[model samples]
Target: MRVNKWGVGVILAASVLLTGCAGGSDKPADEKPSGAAQEENAAPESDCPELKDGATIDGAALSECVTEAMADSAGFAAKMTTLGMESTSRYNPAEAAVATDTTFGSVVVIGEDAWVKSATGEWQAADTASTDPTVVALSTAAKAVDASDPMGVAGTLSGEYTVTGTGTRLGQDVFLLTGVTEEGGTSVDMVFELTSDYVVLAATGSTELEGQKIESVQEITEWDVEQDIIAPL
Candidate 1:
């Protein structure tokens, strides 16, 4: 199948930003803003913010933690469910397909989640592992890692601005990131957020698709991260 180059490009860009530029620099020539560095050099997380000991993550390590957490499909699934992406599991392929069609902008999950297809093509699971990489990666990419000590991710990561905004879902502090990027010859808007502990709480990416900028938002509540106590993402 032909690739939605713009779709993949935007997703990749979001991933790099959320990973705190940890993946290193290497952009395909097809990428835009020629000569623009793909990686942003951020100071070690030790410079970000701080939370109480054993209750928080170091800023530098926070990025790594989020990268790992976002890679966990179960965690992301939980968040997606909160965002109303339920029934798209390995058990119910049909519901998953319908759900994806209603929400996702560029792609959606179909089948028992054993397989996923977007405008680009199909993605078969490499193993029976329940974790969904796409969900985790997208969720993680939306969060903003702290810049100081205990660099937990908490907030959004947008192109023009990133910050810890207000709002709470499932009882976790919500942050916001917003900005714009050009795609398919049009300017698109993006917004995503992280929990206080650095988990992606929710995210929404909107672009002109089907003649309108469709918005999809995911809210992850029911956090069990802190011994069942109320804590930040």
Candidate 2:
């Protein structure tokens, strides 16, 4: 893992934000995004917030720790799942990639440019800068890092965060955090899985819209690991 990482984001952050930037399709997809190797630093465990079982910490402190760790990431890959939609993303400092498979189809974007998988499973160049509102919306997903989050991420959901206690995720010890995040004037209940050194392992949230409960999950599978991401010509 690289050095210092993470910072809070609007809502659902980057993983959820980028989950479906690509429309859905059934065609075969290209290779996963690639990234170049760059070594970074990671916050030592001792420097992180102390987690005690059944203890509580201020939400703002938890949020700050997560925010810092996310920004310090050297490379990472993650998935976001919601309403039967699943997306995979990979990021390193040099590049990033996001792919979503859903009814709209599959898509890949690097910076402001995009590529769509044709019905025949071929990659077609997409103009993210087009005047079309739909196209513009797709490009709006653009991030400073190769049209994506600098971390192969979208970003993270941030709010007044409170650490409920300590726990484990996928076998790694972690701090469990709870908070409510809002965007567009809508609020959702969110739970975060954070590592000892402040690495974000996953975050999940839910909200009611039109009397229907909607939920989203962000799972960080890799942190500060090696990654390879490349853009299609």
Candidate 3:
């Protein structure tokens, strides 16, 4: 299967997100956290996807579920831990806007208007006039992807998935969904921890190549929390 540009961008950012590892989470399936846990330390989502041990949901359905959650949520917040460095992102569905704080700096985008800040520099609009490579690339990516894309990256994936089992994590009921597809010599795989109601708690992806391997993971540390995202410029 051929992954589109949108999909590739996800791989790169997520890969960059967890540069320290080639493996997914170490938490065992049996002891994993809630599939729909909200706030890393706060309560879990009141509305979540829960399924029986033998129940199942397809990839299309999974994608639709996540997409709905993204479009419907009033606001969304998540903390991504990569290589011991953390970045927290807040998304506003009403305005199709997002604000992210990374170890290196900060990024904010509202519609086609984007801004970037360096760890020690002031926020600058990442407009067409920008010459900085990173700013240029970020601007391109922001305009290319559908605003809904960032909220649920797994929803952007192409393939199928079904419930593997069920359990309790972070005091919330959880389900496991998995799928894998291959084209030619390349194989792609995805794993998602979901609330039976369809909220994503975590997602992981990996693929293999001759003599080389790559993997990326983004575990949701918080979800649907308060946010005050706005243009920095």
Candidate 4:
């Protein structure tokens, strides 16, 4: 099986933003948001839920937690690393930082248009007329990490999972969950880290791909804050 490195990044990045798909009406170059309009369009503060430490989580409860987090969150910034390549993304409802890395360079999406960053760091138009698979994947995965959402961090699992422990991460309290899946006699171990408010902070897992071992991690460092994810052009 041929593995598209970019697709792997997209799958991990999707963990952060799994609520909606990306696509919108095209905006003329002249219609891009400016000073005041940009400020006016900024995301609002998230009303994160109040969850105590040592709380238990199952698949259904996990889904509800993710729903609440995504609904309250304005947007988020995420880093996903797989096999040694890393892609960082920032997303709000209106704009997305897109997939960016040293290997595949970068792509930015705003409304219905997408742009690719050149080797010289110049931005150029990408095919957004129909639907570019990469762009669509980037779009749907650009929302915010909702741990309970199947489209989010738990996309790889098949059976049930349980929250096993609580601990501190970067001075913040977090809940830990683990799940195991078997495929072709290989066992994949998945672990998740969630905040006291039920927001997913990170997820790490290991599995074999085409007889090669691959480990992946996805982390959400910032959310519900003002992020300047503007069009590169």
Per-candidate TM-scores read: 0.37, 0.64, 0.69, 0.59
Q: Is candidate 2 or candidate 3 better by lDDT?
A: 3
Q: Any runs in candidate 3 off by more than 4 Å, and if so which?
A: 1-10, 14-51, 82-85, 154-157, 181-186, 209-212
Winning model by lDDT: 3
lDDT for each residue of candidate 1 in 1-233, tens digit (9 for 90 to 100): 11122122233333322222221123221222212112222323433343322232333434454434333322222222211232111111113221121122112223222223222334433232327554344323222111121111222221343453556554445456555545546565655565444455455556555564444333332222211111111
lDDT of 2 by residue, 1-233 (tens): 11111212223333323344333232222222223212234664434457665555555555455556665666666665565565555655445444433333345655455665533344556545665543343334332233223332223344445678776554467777777766456786877787666666777767776776667666765566655655555
- Cα-based lDDT at residue 33, candidate 1: 24
Tens digits of lDDT, candidate 4, 87-165: 5655564342343433344556555555664333455666434255544443333332222231254333346566678
Local distance difference test, each candidate: 0.32, 0.51, 0.54, 0.49
**Candidate 1, lDDT over the whole model:** 0.32
Evaluated at residue 206, the lDDT of candidate 4 is 79
Which pairs in model 3 have colliding backbones? 34-169, 48-197, 49-195, 49-196, 49-197, 49-198, 50-196, 50-197, 59-161
Please identify which of the two predictions, 1 or 3, would achieve the higher TM-score against the true structure: 3
The parts of candidate 1 lying over 4 Å away from their true place are: 1-65, 69-76, 79-158, 181-186, 221-233
lDDT of 2 at 78: 65
Q: Write the per-residue lDDT of candidate 3 for residues 171-210, one digit (tens) a residue.
A: 4566777777443345667666766556666665567645
Worst 10 residues of 3 by lDDT: 1-10
Q: Give the TM-score of candidate 4.
A: 0.59
